[model samples]
Target: MASGTEIPAETVAGRKGALSTVISIDAMGGDRGPAAVVAGLVLSAAELPDARFILHGDQAVLSPLLARAPTLAGRVDLRHAERVVTMEDKPSQVMRHGQGTSMFSTIDAVKNGEAPVAVSCGNTGALMAVAMLRLRKLPGVNRPAIACYWPSRNPSGLNVMLDVGADIKAEAADLLQFAAMGTSYARNSLGLARPRVGLLNVGTEEHKGRAELHQAYAQMSAAASAGEFDFVGFVEGSDIPSDRVDVIVTDGFTGNVALKTGEGTAKLISGFLREALGSTLLARLGALLAMGALKRLQARADPRRANGGVFLGLNGTVIKSHGSADATGIAAAVRLAHQLARADLANRIAARVASTGLAGQDAAATGAEAGTAE
Candidate 1:
């Protein structure tokens, strides 16, 4: 038997119906191990008293952790998973021999409908492979994408960017699908009705970029009105942090490079500020005077606050937390998964894909008719 704080009065009723509120977690996949995962769960449990967790890991390791987190006892259901997928393991290797592993079990829970969403801080490639194989893609979705929240100058303080690393290649039609999927995600998750969509390109000029991008630009421009999104035409890399667009669509190769570059730049800026603030006695004193403002700035720019990279266009929602994430980052990922699950994000993506498919079919039919008339 496990130990933890009893479920609160308010959450008791909801706990009875755990299917919707439960989140499947891979407790042994992170770099920090089960301790950080459990600590994160404790933090999340404090905030979301009604949310339940289906933890997958070795019972010997997780049992003690749960015993320490009394507040999370009754809310957690542990499933013993003997194996773990390591960071060094290739996706192909894991796919063939990853059965009974925590990551696989965590995703299986969501696929089996035991939980609505799954959160894991594991190998990205392996996780993606397992997810695609198990959860599969939604109807009309050719290639699934990994979408992440980018801190930006938008009113909501964040913008949605997709195809971060799911697939390195995307055609003109795939880009349009990304835009439509991103629009739905913004609407459901960010509460934006008709999000402004922008395609990342070399420049905002009409003739810029590769031939595929140019073709994609024309398609996106023509479909903007019908897609219920405002296409701001082509946008440069700088527009990712700008408030001009709520969704930035790009192929995975470009998006991944941009994502890593942005993360590194943010870290460099933060380090410079710290160094400047502590270089001299007077500088330290000045920092003390501005401590409160600095705290606010740190809070606003904290990457941990936006820890989850959502895998969109799948039949189920899967949140990939950073492998090196600590307790706070894990909690943030759990919080995001809970939010997306509550909003029925999977169903929303399905509807968006279906709509886009119909639109493509209509356009093709129209072109065929025109050819016949000519």
Candidate 2:
């Protein structure tokens, strides 16, 4: 039996009855531990007036934390798990012996229909492994991808990019599926009716990029109509944050590198701006005059505002929050998860893939064979 006090059956009945949208959370997964997770829940509760949470972690550790957070008294359902998956734990080991861990318990809640979404700041690999094992992949999804929001110049102020570290490699068909999934995400999350998707390449020219990208380009182009998205052929790295495309599709290797590089560049630029502003009295005076604009810029460019990465192609929606996320970052992730859940994100992606026929078994098999041959 789980040790923590379970929210009453009547209180936790349906997603819409007592709670708005319940999100299962791995309280023990983050670097800041359960305290930060509980704090995040308090923050999220204020932001999402209708949101509820199922927090899974060690009872002894979490009980005290919850007692300290009186605001979350009836809003959270606590599930006790004795073990935790450390950052050092390998995905393979977790998959083999993950039954009693908090991460597994968190995913299992979504798997069992207790919640529509699962959020974790745990080991990405282990979390993905447990999710795939418990929730399994959505039908017609060959290789699941991790899609994240990128601060962009678009009207919506964000662009969706996928495979941001779920798997290092993506075949042509996989990339095609990523496009469909990303388009679904953009449509649902950003309220875009027909999202423009661009395959990531060295250049925008159709002739550029390797064989797989070319193949993906052709496949996405053909399926654009059925997928209800506009395929913009190829998009270069510079176009990622541009308003030209709503979704950027690429393999995990390139996407992860780009994601990290962009984050590092943002930090570097912010540091440079701070140093330059403080270097001279004149610059400091100028900064003080533009303080409001600078604050707006800071808020607009804050990575914490776009923290969660949605694990696409899963049977249940799973959000991977950054492991080092603090209370604000965790709350941001939880908010994103709740937004996606309210939008019925999982069903939208599945329906898009199924209707497009891009996820057919033959296409996946062919792409897998081609990837191996390469």
Candidate 3:
């Protein structure tokens, strides 16, 4: 069992009414191809026994790998494809030319109800674009956002952030959409009620923002007043550590930078610790004294926990992990996908939007003449 502090108090309550979770994984879509993802699928399968697995990729490429791991072969159904989308390809190019690509096939399967969730560590851009264009919105959403669950220093509940690396050039309306979408995500996925919403601005001041920022701020402010959400105002990147808010909102570009910066920082610190502990026996002894503390810190910093990113607002669940993610990362992603499917994120989001009667219109949110979101 995980240490009490290492787990959330809500885990038990959250697992009360679990749903049937099935996932389709892009078996050969990441930087390392099928090897790492297949290993992760096997690991996740053992952990999530109820999660049926369909591994989509080039049969020839994956068959040999699975032949070596016969145990995995018996568990996973092989879904064959021809082409593979590369890491360096343009989003549009990959979507159009990367026909029969594992990522596309996996997403298609999830959308078609072959599975409840799809996990990909491949071309993130293509995954988001394809999920949006294909699965479309889940009833009341305008644009789908990338949702990452953040572990807080408080350890009470996981914070959710969105729009990471999707629309860097997003406008105010887009940010507001992200906020609403995030609110829905927090409620549906994390089971947080009246989840706190925050705008990731430079400062907490109402006036602190860019041109688009000002517009988005005003819109979200009105939404809060209208009782649409529990909007908590602007938040700085520094506030991510504390449990000040349940959802941090921003545009795709800004959110991506924040997410990458956080990831890089974690890597840098971990590397520094390894190097420090390796150099001398004296330092190693010092590390040993603090091994428990170090494990706790490292566990908190582990990318595996944050590896899964939800493509919020989609008709179906699509998860994106880091482009360089390996087997361990992929395994965590499948677990997260299972968690999301069990939570029924899409349906919850739809219900929240419907209850607000806002549905597709947040015009009044824009502080405009109550027109479109713009």
Give TM per candidate: 0.90, 0.90, 0.84
Q: For candidate 3, lDDT tens digit of each residue in 9-107?
A: 222222223323467788766777688887877688678765667788889888888788766644677899887777777888775676677878888
Best by lDDT: 2
Question: Which model, 1 or 3, shows the larger lDDT?
Answer: 1
**Among all windows of ten consecutive residues in candidate 2, which has the lowest summed lDDT?**
365-374
List ranges where model 2 is wrong by over 4 Å: 1-19, 356-374
Tens digit of per-residue lDDT, candidate 1, span 61-107: 99988998999978899999999999999999999899999999999
**How high is the lDDT of residue 267 in model 2?**
96
lDDT of 2 at 15: 53
RMSD of 2: 8.4
User: How much is the lDDT of residue 3 in candidate 3?
Assistant: 28
How well does candidate 1 score on lDDT at residue 242? 94
Q: After best superposition, candidate 1 residue 17: deviation in angstroms? A: 3.5
lDDT of 1: 0.84
Q: Order candidates by lDDT, high to low.
A: 2, 1, 3
